[model samples]
Target: MLESLSVPKRRVAAQFVLPGGSSRKVAVFLAEAVPGREGGERLSDLLNGSGPRFIPAHDAETDAMTFVHRENLALARVAAEHEPNVVDPFNLPTEHEVELRLVDGQALHGIIAYVLPEAHSRLTDYLNSAPPFFPLLEEGGQHVVLVNKHHVAYVETLRR
Candidate 1:
């Protein structure tokens, strides 16, 4: 009876690469709907939000629940549909093509969007001020990579 009182959640498949280079397939449960958002709680929200230090996920292969330390994640790949719409016209958004090199020697190329003040609008300033986990929209537009700023060795700006 008590279980019915809980908010509904849906499982979204994702791939997580740990700082040590281990990759895992897991399902993250997200709320059916967020208070102000149109759809469910996004995977980005779960990773970047200040909810907890550990994220709860279900192992895809074993079906066992596991808690991963948020800080240890190198990157998380999720479907584009799982991310919230980030195109904010009011902020005068800018998209930068970039290559993020991870500490584990893997490099990913994508476009990162940012809206910053004119005086501090460079890519360096954006990266420095961005949150720990930020979204990198993949080239093909099928996936979004939530990168851990802590694991990025350096970011090379490909194009403005």
Candidate 2:
């Protein structure tokens, strides 16, 4: 009980640049009361494991290393629990000015709005999961536009 009282709050703020040419800001729980190098370490581990690995992790059955994004795994859970075509009914998404650079050398400029994650929410990973299409508001919020995840190459912030 004393530990609970002494524990301070913590969280992680992450931004995802989806393959479909769209990006979104996400917030997730840190699972740590006092944040440190843990998050950076986790990201580093992921990056290091991306390439081929000839050495055994201790056995011949071990395969080459793979880059795994935890967010992708979390997205699966969210997708299973909700309808993919329609977003869960929540508060209106926040609008942000963003520029998307596509793999085909095309670009899309608009305001993307998404439901802000709950404060100090640990569920940010689940929220980062890439959907088939991201529903964004464009044309000055006059149209509900769908940005396919597969088509996106990268996303950039027009303004901080």
- Quick one: best TM-score, which candidate? 1
lDDT (0 to 1) per candidate: 0.89, 0.40
TM-score of each: 0.91, 0.37
Q: Which lDDT tens digits does candidate 2 get at residues 1-160? A: 7886763433333333444434443432222322343222221122223433221121113333323343332111111111122334656545567776657665767665555466623223322563455554444544433454555677776775
Looking at model 1, the pairs that clash are none
lDDT of 1 by residue, 1-160 (tens): 9998998999999999997778999999999998876887988889989999899999998889999998899999999988855666688687889988998899899889888888998888889998899999999989999999999999888855
Model 1, residue 52: what's the lDDT? 94
Clash totals for all models, in order? 0, 5
What is every candidate's alpha-carbon RMSD to the true fold? Answer: 1.6, 14.6
> What range of 10 consecutive residues in model 1 has the weakest lDDT sum?
84-93
